[model samples]
Target: MSDSTTSIKTFRYRLYPTRAQEAAMFETLRLTRTLYNAGLEQRREAYRKHGKTLSAYDQQKELTALKEACLEFSGVYSHVLQDVFDRLDKAYKAFFSRVKKGAKRAGFPRFKPATRWDSFKFKQCWNNAKNDWTACGKPVDDGRRISIPKIGNVKIKLHRPLEGKPKSLQIVLDVDQWYAVYTCEVPVQPLPTTGSSVGIDLGTTWFAVTSDGEFIENPRHLGRSLGKLRVQQRTVSRRKKGGNRRKKAVKQVAKTYRKVRRQRLDFQHKTARRLIHEHDLIAHENLQVGNMAQSNLARSILDAGWAGFLFQLAAKAESAGRRVIAVDPRYTSQRCHACGHTGKENRVNQASFRCVQCGHTANADHNAAKNILDRGTSTERGEPLGRAVPSGENGSGVSHAVA
Candidate 1:
């Protein structure tokens, strides 16, 4: 349901660099990691010894001297080294922000290790919007090969042709695989208006409940992959540390977990796309999923992927010209849609709801969803809300049945 507009869209493609190219990229990563650690050390030392804080600009100005002293740094691209300073600057800013917020664990910026530093960004790219080869990492015309600065061109599997003005680019290493991620300015793809509005109640059991009374089943991606994941974890932990066997085992575990993560992302993306297609306005509770995850059901709550789904929905909606409203979540499950009565007695069971004062009853989730929908659409402006199109409505209808 997104309105037509321009938005930044990211595209990911697999990279198949040859052995020599891959080695060059790995060495570049090592150099960047060492530079990052050295920068952090300078910052800490300056503050401790002289009560002086070093800025990214301050440290970056010394790169000329650094390159002369350590000639290996010259082998890396100039912009890449500059971007490392930007990363360090961002990390320090975040660390201070968390400290001011009184976070329990104010994650101070730490030095990077080879394993932790897996991606590097190219801040400078063409503003002209072409996806072809250039100075900063560029993809070729046939979309089969991409060039990395200071490294040779490598074979790329471009599943889809890149479109729009290229903004920024990154080379990321996931486990043993490589991917090229590109951000581009693209026009938003808005779907035909359906006039349907829905309020969704997200849950662990049903995955989602709609005001129209449709229930969606949760796929439980993580729970389903636990068996294989457990076996992989056991193999990794059993292997001797620092050995080739251990490294291989770790990669295996990472790939297995990555599969589960991809599945969850795919599921959420598809689900959000469906809602955006069917509705002009989507209403959902402004749930703090992070806070909710602290309970005993943390694993299940996290596996549900509510936060990711909502974020995706809102983004899609904005792009499509649809509206997504986050309503207050308080008492949505307890409040009765029939007579406005709200109390603990309203919830008869997990799947059933009963209004004690009005003697109105319905499926718990369905009733909650209706209340949520009402709150979202009800306003002083009295603007018309599009009735759900019959062609798109597929709810297994509900009826009153007081127990």
Candidate 2:
């Protein structure tokens, strides 16, 4: 094996800071949010009054004056403060780019409320030559504790071994918990080659149907927790505004949502791993899920989590040296895999499919999976990736070659 790094990945750990350290972390978030807003306001006023544009470098050059004006700003690391301006710059650039494209909603950057600003990042961390980490953040005492710039060493739960050199660190707050996420330049170890291939059909009623007749059932995690969420939401509404009771109720609702999100993510990761491990090449529809979710079946479509599943599948495939191909989804649902006949009437119902021309019948999703496989293989093998050709008299089953 060559001693070379292949990829970069992130590792997250739960942090348990002392009360004082917690206060310091919160202060860092608040100051960063304040700085972000101030920078945004300066740009807006500058543009409105003088018709001048302020670049990130211009704003960054004024950081010294800012620190002198506000004593609290000096407490945080200088690089961290620079990142706040960088974030605002990114937002403005995105806004202008969207406007140039004539987007309907050219989302202008808005002020972030205290509740929304939940994280701060340190851009630099590792030192390779000296084999030493910086003072702003470093793993302490064999990774059990981590030292922050303003805050002392905070206890950490190192769930997994850290790989590669740490590049940057982000301290995130979710609900009441603080997490330290480290992005690293890890070496990738690709799995052994698998000669297998499979095509998948994604649906709301079923999570996925493989070309080999494997049906992965949808868990409907969100639907299962929806009743509890309604109860928590009602509790929040009944509580008085700006009261501790209401805040607590709101947190409860957020916690429930987090639980459901976790469940869905867990399921997707596991399923993606299974497919990547078992197959050398995987194919699925290149669905426009965002557009699809705008219809009346939006709730059901979102609940299926097709986008997340596909993303996870792609990520895992990339890391494992596997192939994931997204084929056109045009007539996969209506086209008959047996005879190349295409018609809406072929879909007998949500679950069944019957070819009117050749009398071959199968599950609707299974037929779609087969067609997806054919499309993927045809494209991969340099053949015309088109609808299946009609075969024998009356358009009987047409055999197609695939590698």
Candidate 3:
């Protein structure tokens, strides 16, 4: 693919490694975690004692000394070891960025225990021309196996054919399972235009409410699995700490949570795909999900996963040559769609919107979606942000199509 038309996309697959390879992977994970923690400590101490900041390169240069001092460090791939420091640097950069924005919680980088350090990246691995994996064993071109340095060829279950050139590989450890995530540079092709447009209202009660009054109900995967999760967690609590039984129980709990996460992710992807397939332009509120999650309905807000859904929507839309706009969310719920009267009384309940001034009533979420649609239309047309048409002003009733 030409550079202008190419985009990067990731595809993940399950990896089945032998017992020895699994042991090696665990050792590598432990060492990587140690390296990350050490890098974090060095940065913290340097700044505290001398008011000096260390770049990733500065810490990376010390890797040779680290390997010389610790035999375990030498066993890990050099690039993989370097990536640990890179991860730390990125975390520190993000923390400072948040601090500059006056965030209440500018999270400091913390040490990662073995359980928390789950993934490592390999920027270059597969060499297609040579039919070899760099610095590792060769991989069969049939997509059945992939070789890794310090580990032998691992079995791969190919669910789909890989397209384009593989650019990077990420080895992920989820609970007790292993996965290889491949990012490839592929050609981006625009889909045929349908000239359709829509605005969406996301909520905990409803997954998505479109401007056309279509409601997608939220699937509370986590809530539904909470009972079983509690049972598994209780089993863990009952077992003696550091015992095999406790470890097994812990894995069970993690597996349950992971299942919930996968279910949520699958739903989000399918929902986003359907929206992008039907509409050429999509609009949604640019919500501060983090701040919203800090409210009284924190659990519900987090479970909604609105941010992740929007992110998926944007990605799909980009690949499909569609536009997804985020409008200002202020007053969207309280503003009277029919009369343009903004009042707290406009939204009498969660589901009902009634304009006190003109006595116009409609589904609260639906009305908000319409206003969002109008704002999006204005934005698309390059009109002033303040311009929005009232519902009855032009005799365009509730049945009017979003486009």
Per lDDT, the best of the predicted structures is 2
Candidate 3 lDDT tens digits, 65-102: 98998887888888888888889889988989989988
lDDT values of the candidates?
A: 0.81, 0.85, 0.83
TM values, all candidates: 0.84, 0.86, 0.91
How many collisions per candidate?
A: 9, 0, 0
Overall local distance difference test of candidate 1: 0.81
For model 3, name the residue pairs that clash. Answer: none
Candidate 2 at residue 325, lDDT? Answer: 90
**Residue by residue across 1-403, what tens digits does model 2's lDDT show?**
1133355667889999989999999999999999999999999999999999999889999999988998999999888889888889999998998798776677799999998899999888877678878875698888889988876799999999888778889999988899999987766668897778899999987999999999999989999999999999999999999999999999999898888888998999899999999988898999868667778989877888889999889877766667889998877888888877777778899999998878889999999999998888877777777854333354444433322
TM-score of 1: 0.84
Between candidates 2 and 3, the one scoring higher on lDDT is 2
Rank all candidate structures by their lDDT, best first, as comma-separated numbers.
2, 3, 1
Judging by lDDT, tell me the better candidate of 1 and 3: 3
lDDT of 2 at 369: 96
